[model samples]
Target: MMIKKLFALFLMLLWPSLSMAQTETITHGSLAIDRAVMRAALPGSKVTAAYMTITNNGAEADRLIGVEFSGAKKSEIHSMEMDGGVMKMRPVTGGLEIKPGESVTLEQGGLHLMFMGLTERPADGETRTLTLIFQKSGSLTITLPVKMMMGGHKTSS
Candidate 1:
């Protein structure tokens, strides 16, 4: 009886960490990518977005050339901006540059990874693999957890 009570207490203490998003940081050359997350696709929606922070820690600059997602038929780096009182989204041509010693954030309403024609809708609490290709660093793969964004807050579904 005492061991059962202790086991329950241990689980209660460890639940928060287990439920949190994946915190793994992937690095290639001087580039480090972290805080990677993908939003769960809405029902009947075939598209979703991913966001992350990329930092260049070396003296040379690098460019994020492309992305590979096995779950989607197509993926592109896209930017959203306001133009002429309207919001416009388009694929970023020539890739995105990361200057030396600078950090670039890919977030909502800005630059993000657009995954289109998903083979299957990713459910909340599931994980997916993403490969980021850089001009100088080659390729690096990272795992992203699917999360739901509600009212500007991330909640595990």
Candidate 2:
């Protein structure tokens, strides 16, 4: 009985780290992609968004040309802007550029990945795969965790 109680206490102490979402970094050539996360899709919602940071570690510049995700029928790099007191979202044309030794962050209310026609709605704690195609770095595949947005912050569900 004492051993069982101690084991339970140990698990309780380790629960937070076990339940927290883990951030993963994937690299290809001189490009490193990190902090990749997708928002949990609400019920009956066919669209969702993802965000990440891409860093260029080499001397040459590169462009993010395309994205691939099997869970969605279409994926595009998008940007949101306020135009004359109105918010507008549009697809980024000609790809996004990343200069040498610079990091480009795709985040909410700015640049992000727009996934439309979702074949599967992502739930909290789910892991999804995303393939990023770059102009110079080629293709890099990264795994992203689906996190719930609560009060403008990400939380594990």
Candidate 3:
């Protein structure tokens, strides 16, 4: 199915990070979030991004409804697509869906977290707490350690 293939592609892109950060996964009931990291940004920069993998372990689907952080003036779930060799990014209109027993990855050049109007620049090697609201799980808070890059330590072009 198309959904299966898309999920598989996400998994493949996330495979390297998963293999390297096996111990970094955080689980609650039927949900798990892995390798959640925020990219480093220069001061005065208006935007930054975060990446992670979210998994549902139960026999029911869930949706990631919202993301919150005090450091940014605005936080949004964004998706990126390549159009004729051009990369375009935009906010995801609806919430991101997660299937039962399935994992969804948010990474560079795809579905990701976008932070704008940062109150303060994200610091490297430091941790910031991010609250994720799920359709079924209500809210789950996790520490997002600020890092220069993610997923095999590769930076975006």
Task: Give candidate 2 regions above 4 Å deviation.
Answer: 1-23, 150-157
CA displacement after TM-score superposition, residue 100 of candidate 1 (Å): 0.3
How do the residues 1-157 of candidate 2 rate in per-residue lDDT, one tens digit apiece?
Answer: 9999999999997764464334356667898787889988888878888999999999999999999999999999988888999767789999999999999999877788988888899998998999999999898888889987643322222
- CA lDDT of every candidate: 0.84, 0.84, 0.82
- TM-scores, all models, native as reference: 0.80, 0.80, 0.78
| Predictions: Cα RMSD each | 9.5, 10.2, 11.8
Poorest 10 consecutive residues of model 3 by lDDT? 148-157
Backbone N/Cα/C clashes per model: 0, 0, 0
Off by over 4 Å in 1: 1-23, 151-157
Write the residue-wise lDDT of candidate 1 on 1-157 in tens digits: 9999999999997764465435466567788787899988878777888999999999999999999999889999989888999767789999999999999999877888989888888878999999999999898988889987653322222
Error of 1 at 105 (Å): 0.3
TM-score between candidate 3 and the true structure: 0.78
Q: Of 1 and 3, which scores higher on TM-score?
A: 1
lDDT score for residue 87 of model 3: 73
- Candidate 2 local Cα displacement, residue 122, angstroms: 0.7
Model 3 global lDDT (CA atoms, 0 to 1): 0.82
